[model samples]
Target: MASRCIVLLVAVLLSSLLVVSSSASSSPCTFPAIFNFGDSNSDTGGMAAAFATVSEPNGETFFGEPAGRYCDGRLVIDFIAQTVGLPFLSAYLDSVGTNFSHGANFATAGSTIRRQNTTFFQTGYSPFSLDAQSWQFAQFKSRSQLAYKKGVSYKDQLPPEEYFSQALYTFDIGQNDLTSGYVSNMTTEEVKQTIPDILNKFTDVIKSVYGLGGRYFWIHNTGPFGCLPYVLDRYPLRAPEVDSVGCGAPFNEVAQLFNAELNETVAQLREAFPRAVFTYVDVYTVKYSLISHAEKNGKTHQC
Candidate 1:
């Protein structure tokens, strides 16, 4: 009789827990759109479009054709959408393929969180730069308007809110700001002074995306510069460290400071925008792991 009572009690507790879990699973931020804003790492095509260069050799391995992305193909933003049952984001230049009813990508090849990167990347524009992906995002609304006028709407039937809810906004920039601008030229002390300013600007960008009805937001820290080809070429002496997965102290030190500031900034943003769902993907960690495990994946370290 005592055993029966215990089993009955356990069953009741399980039932109660199920109710709680179900209620918590329903988040208001579960929307339908996904906006991606970042550099080559997350850019699906912003760079390719700007450079007028389609898929590169490395990119051909994954995405096939040239979708303007910088990776082997598909990036974090692509998987994020797929995780939520959304289709791959359409490229900014892909007029016929774009489906803004959900979300769009605004990541250029050399984009950064700072205006300096914005003004420095594009050879023709120099200041016209690859980092102005966010500016392209501003054009989405107008582009949508014209899409309808041109009779090329992807989802003319759905309500805006329903469409927006399905969206996810992401910003994966700053790599160039750190990698291109400061990493090569400036000393540690000079870079330290600018870290706070960099963090603050990134925080503001996250909030801006949220204000645009972007409930789902993600911020990327930075990709490893030590692993890039340029770094390998510049510091051949550090090849030993690279092979050991022990990054050169100087480059790694800069990365650490940047990541620390990034973490603190992310924490502050979370508190400021309690209603917004913010996630930070640690690209540094990913890069490090990929470097350490390159051989396991049957690949050799390039940079």
Candidate 2:
């Protein structure tokens, strides 16, 4: 549950925004500041320990130890940052001052859009929820402005004004609401009904950043939840016919439907703000590619 995800988006070369096949890759994204929003796939340290439970094996492999990321190696966000020559950022909760120099990761593990509210309970630390993350962005903007007034330079020496001007955002989420093992009681229809509200929450989150001057973003359509280990644990020996990729039918159908509605919603957002770039990454296809061909990623193919 702690493997929260995050994504990094930058000025998409509109010409290159088209989704490509596995043979080729996307062009280098150009962006200044990066803000991530999502569940375990992109969360850096937020899943590591912002809450009371243990943050285990979240950032292993490439980092060698916990850097708070949920996956084994650098996620897409890290790859994009590296592509643009930026240092790996720190989670917002890290007291380390260097995290402020580049970008800050606001993703929280086991969190959702409009799900958790920021609060302090004596039992454990409550990480920033989507609403809380937006508010924190406001504070970040103010502090950055102050830094500008004093002439403190960013890591690349870009002015705070330019920092945000070149900023980009990414979001890879929405699976947790339906797939968390604890929520097995929820029917597929119940999950589908929640899509509209999820999109609404996402709109609110995006607008909050827009208010803070974010003009470019990449939102991922939901992934095939039926392929995850937890899902397979529930329904092994699944029909390969229901899933061309052998994941499953029920979960993929929900993800596909959610992605369809999300695309329409993104089109609406694009229409409203023509100047802003809103791109949707194909989490569905990407995961399919990875799962169907795990050898490409050097992992054991499994249920």
Best by TM-score: 2
Error of 2 at 69 (Å): 1.6
Reference-based lDDT, residue 265, model 2: 88
Best by lDDT: 2
What RMSD does model 1 have?
11.5
Candidate 2, residue 17: how far the Cα is off, in Å: 5.9
Q: TM-score for every candidate vs. truth?
A: 0.75, 0.78
The per-model lDDT (C-alpha) reads: 0.56, 0.62
lDDT of 1 by residue, 8-92 (tens): 1222332343234335556633446677776665656655665567535535655565666555445656655665557777666
Where is model 1 more than 4 Å wrong at Cα? 1-24, 27-31, 117-132, 142-162, 182-184, 235-243, 297-303
Clashes of 2: 13
lDDT of 1: 0.56
What range of 10 consecutive residues in model 2 has the weakest lDDT sum?
Answer: 6-15
